[model samples]
Target: MSAILEVENLRVAYPSRQGPVEVVRGVSFALGRERLGIVGESGSGKSQTGRAILGLTAAGGRVTADRLHFDGIDLRGASPRIWRQLRGRRMSMVMQDPKFSLNPVMTIGRQIVEAGRRGGVSRRDAKARALEMLEAVQIRDPGRVFDAYPHELSGGMGQRAMIAMMLVGRPDLLIADEPTSALDVTVQLEVLGILDDLVRDRGMGLVFISHDLRLVSTFCDRVLVMYAGRVVEEIAAADLDRATHPYTRGLLNCLPRIDAEARPLPTLERDADWAR
Candidate 1:
C-alpha cells in the first residue's frame, strides 16, 4: 500500500547574513498507519522537517521538496489557501507548548468545539464530540474542563486537552512535535499511551518528533536518527540497541543505564562526517 504521507528530498532554509541557513537538507521519509519517530539533539532540524511538511515553517524559512504528498494529494506547490483547508481537517499538528497554542481568552470547550466546527460538524454536535474526546484523553471532570479557561488548567491537563482538540477532526495524519515535553514523567507515559490508542483505533499515521532517543526507541515503531539537517540512520525502533550509524551508536552509549557502571554516563562522540 502507498504511504499516507510521503516526502522526498525536502529542504528548508532561512536567509542569513552568512548566506542561507539550511535547517532541513534533503530529508525524506514516508509514513503509514504506524508511529514513526524522528529523533535528534537540539538544533538538528528534526522539528523543522516536521513543520515543513505541515506548512508551518517559521518566519523567513522556505520549504521545498521534489515531491510532498499527503493522502495522495500533491503538496509541493500548494498555495496557502489550499494549505489552510488541508491542515487541521485532513491533517493536524500538536505543538509542544499548549500555553502558546491555546487562546488565553477562549474557554477550553469553545476552542475544542471550534476545531470540530471547522471540520463541518454542527455547533451542538461539536460540543458533544468535544466532551467525548476530552473523556477519551483521560481528562476527568469533563464539565469543569470544558468550562475552564486555558490558564485554569495544569500543564498535563492542558496538554491532554490539546491532544483532544487535535484528534477531534479525526485527521488522517498527525504530526506531534514533542507533545509530552512539558508534562511530568508519569503524564508523559499516559499521553504516549493515549496516542498509541488513537493510532490503533483510528488507523492514523503519526510522526513523533523529539530529542528523547530512549523514549522514542521504546515508543515508536520505526526511528529516524537525524544529525545536523539530514537523516543519518533509519532503523526499527526495537533494533535501536544495535543501530549502526555512528550518531545512533553515540546516542545509545550516552544514555544512562540501570545496571551498569560508570558514575557519569559516557558522553556521545560525533564526528564531522556524521553530518554528511
Candidate 2:
C-alpha cells in the first residue's frame, strides 16, 4: 500500500520562561490506507502527536522533524496557504473536545456547511451534504441539530456534530483524537463502523488516538503504545498480549478483566528509564 503520511524524528515543543519544553520527542511513524491506533495516558502526548500531524499544533508550539511528508508533500514549516489548501479538503481531524473545537456562535448546520464549502461543494448542495453527514454519525434528528447552536446541544451531540463537520469533505487522511469518547457504547460502535468502512471502501488512512486500549485492539490493525512523549511499543492489534515492552505489559495488567477477579485494580507503575 502507498504511504499517505511519513514522519521521522518528529518533535513538538513550546517556549517557556526557562527554555523550550518538548511535548512530543522524536516520534516517528508512517501511515497508509489503514487504521493505526495510538494509545497512552492523558499526558502521554498522544493528542499532541495527532495535532502536529495535521499542522494544528498550538500557536507557541514548535514542530520539527527530519522528514514530515504527506502524500509526497513536505509539511515542515508548511505555509498557511498550504495548510488551508489541504485541511478540510484532502485531510481533516476530528478533535477530542468539541466544546473547544466547534464555534459556539455558529449553528451546527452552518459550521458543517462551511466545511463542505471548503472542499468546493456548491452552495446549493452543501446543506444537503451537511445533513447527510450528521445522520451518518448516528444523530437521530439531523434537522433539529442543524439549527441548534453548539451550547444548545449536549456533549454527545456536539461531538457528533464535530465528526460530521470533519467528514463532510471525505478527507483522504483522518486523524481522529478520541472521536467516539463522548458517545454511548452503541453510538461508539456506529462511529467505528463508519471509520472502518471509510478505510475499507474509501481508502482513507486513519490515525486513531485514544486512551482505551481494549477498543483500539478491536478496531485498529496496528497499535502504538506511547509513554512520556515517546512510543514504547509497536505491535499488531491482535497480538497485544504478546507485547514485549514492560510499559505495555503494565498497562494491560492494570485493566480490569471480567474473566479474572482481582480485589484491587492495579495501578500503572512508571519507570523513569522508559522516558529515555
Question: Which numbered prediction scores highest in TM-score against the true structure?
Answer: 2
Give the poorly placed runs of model 2, Cα more than 4 Å off.
none
lDDT of 1 by residue, 149-250 (tens): 999999878988998899888888999999888777876877788789878898889999987888888999999988999999999999999999878888
Error of 2 at 250 (Å): 0.9
- List clash counts for every candidate, in order: 0, 0
Question: Global lDDT for candidate 2?
Answer: 0.92
Over 1-276, each residue of candidate 2 has an lDDT whose tens digit, in order, gives 889999899899999999998889999989999999999889989999989988888899999999999999999978999999999998999999999999999999999999999856797699999989899999999999999999999999999999989988989999999999999999999999999999999999999999899999999999999998988899999999889998999988988898999778787777899999
Query: What TM-scores do the predictions have?
Result: 0.94, 0.98
lDDT score of model 1?
0.88
Candidate 1: clashing pairs of residues: none
Per-residue lDDT, model 2, residue 106, is: 93
